[model samples]
Target: MVQSLNSNVCEERVFSNIFQTLSKDVHNFLRYKYGDNLNPKDKVQEAFIKLWDNCKNVSPEKAKSFLFTTANNMMLNEVKHQKVVLKHQQVKPKHYTNETPEFIMEESEYMKKYQRALGNLTEAQREAFLMNRIEGKKHKEIAEELGISRKGVEKRIYGALEKLRKEIDGI
Candidate 1:
């Protein structure tokens, strides 16, 4: 009975080792490609979860291939989602430098009001606004660097603009 138990434990250890080795390779491959787009840690977690769910059917030899395929599909889905979201965001139209403004006074007033409003904002809000507007960072990038949510960055920018508009009206 002791010999039989030892054999069973050895078999289990071998199976566990195989899964671990294959999963590690799969994570490395995905990290090389999509590391910048999605968190590598999250992708690895998802791959392991799938492996766990399908472990009974997945043979040791085929496990690596399965993990790679699953990780690739996940990265593709993330890329497609980001593309759809970015496509919907409206970009400001570019004007030629030679194009003459019909009213310079309005532009000056707007700048003055915007500056005053910016001065009144909280330090975090002002920093976020400047990073987005003056420094030209995407909301996602700003959020990551500032350690804030994307929605928070969006809110700060919108709030800043609204305050500027109100200040202009008061002027």
Candidate 2:
């Protein structure tokens, strides 16, 4: 088949050639700019799909530029969405309960103190205590997981409990 110099890239062979030549370059460009956490491969694939969608308007000479621009724009959109999600996550929503407002306020205040007390505990104590209480693991189970003796786990839990009780009243 004879191809003109200014022919569009709607042909199968032309599109495939463009994908083969530019996919890796576009993928590496995105990965280097934004880590793999942003799914650069997905962006690259989406960009090529977009290029194929608009292939009638994209000439073979312009395919590389179109792929790179489209890929970069897609990644920017994803990064923007991630930032919005993270921003929303940092905000706490109000809760609806049957308890009185005063009781709920006091409960919220106590919860704040409880969290502070948990943070005040030593890292070792906090880890073991959380594994036992929050995760519902037995002392022996926690000891095995943490590579410590059962007695050591018990001591950490005890110390954590003692510190928590002192720091937060009515815990």
Among these predicted structures, which one has the highest lDDT? 2
The TM-score, computed over Cα atoms with residue i paired to residue i, of candidate 1 is: 0.43
Candidate 1 — what's its lDDT?
0.75
Model 1 lDDT tens row, 1-171: 112322321256644675566666777787888775677667777876787677676665566677789888988888888888888775656666653575566778778777777899888888988999889999999999999999999998888877767766844
Give candidate 2 misplaced runs (Cα > 4 Å).
Answer: 1-3, 95-171
Over 101-135, each residue of candidate 2 has an lDDT whose tens digit, in order, gives 99989989999998999999999999999999999
Alpha-carbon deviation at 141 in model 2, angstroms: 49
In candidate 1, which residue ranges exceed 4 Å CA deviation? 1-15, 91-171
The number of the candidate with the highest TM-score is 2
Global lDDT scores for all candidate models: 0.75, 0.92
